[model samples]
Target: MRKLLSILMILLSIQAFAQDDKSKDRIDYSGEYNGTFTDIKDAEGTMQLFLYQPDKGRTSGIILLTRIVNGKSEVTTGTINIEGNGEFISGNFMPSEIKYIAPREDEDGIMQNTYDSYSCRWEIFGQITDKKGNTIIGKAVPANCVESNLIEFRINKKK
Candidate 1:
């Protein structure tokens, strides 16, 4: 009877540990994010972000361009998937390509127009948070880069 009781206690401990582990892998992101695109050549814009955390370890949102060249505004939707346990987050933008006119000087000394596509990718590294102001003990380094361009942004989450 004592041996059986000991085995039962061990099982209970194992179950509790498993639950804790699962909880630690959860992430919560619910807030408005304002991002500035630095290191961009010949581009001026401020990106307004709205993020919704439908569940742990997952986030989705839309990014709007409040300012850009030619007085044009654009919006794009994207998803963020985070692995809390690994402290890594990666996501891709839908319609992943944006076209814009490249600024150039022509023989006439006037700005000539050339179309170019910019590809975007978001990568984040930091600690995941929960609703009750509790953080899942981890780290995240979030970065966004445009392909084929020298533009890249690396932002650390503000405490």
Candidate 2:
């Protein structure tokens, strides 16, 4: 009887641990979010965001800009620092840098260093209120470039 009871307890413990592991994936801020930036002149069109939880109070996601200011598809990777669990979340999109070879005329008026490189980059910011349930509504702000503007967005947990 003692051996049987011990075996049962061990099985139950294993089951409980497994359940706990699954909860890690059900984070409050993990989901697919869809919304638009409020400022239409600077940035028009819609944006989609996919956010996932790496650990508690942290989130990682991708931001997709469609038909915005530049009339081109833009994708950005971002991280958010969540405080008060799901009360507040804010982060900036890591700037995407492009390096390309450019040919420029030297002082002697001769094209030289055709392999010379140049880079351009832009960044965006997100500040939102976490509903603590399944929705996060926030604003997307552009920075580090020409214009600084605000865009509103709301993201919900994916079913």
lDDT of 2 by residue, 21-109 (tens): 97664446667777664453554556666877665546666665554335665443334333334455556664344434576798999
Clash number by candidate, in order: 6, 4
For residue 98, give model 1's deviation from the true position in Å: 6.0
- Per-model TM values vs. the true structure: 0.50, 0.50
- Once superposed on the true structure, which residue ranges of model 2 sit more than 4 Å away at CA? 1-27, 40-42, 68-84, 95-131
Given candidate 2, what's the lDDT at residue 136?
A: 65
Candidate 1 residue lDDT tens string, 1-159: 999999999999999999989877664555565545533445644544456776554666664443355676644344444433334444444334445567689999998546432335544343334444233332222234323333333332335
lDDT of 1 at 129: 45
> What lDDT is reached at residue 83 by model 1?
36
Q: Candidate 2, clashing residue pairs?
A: 33-155, 37-151, 37-152, 38-152
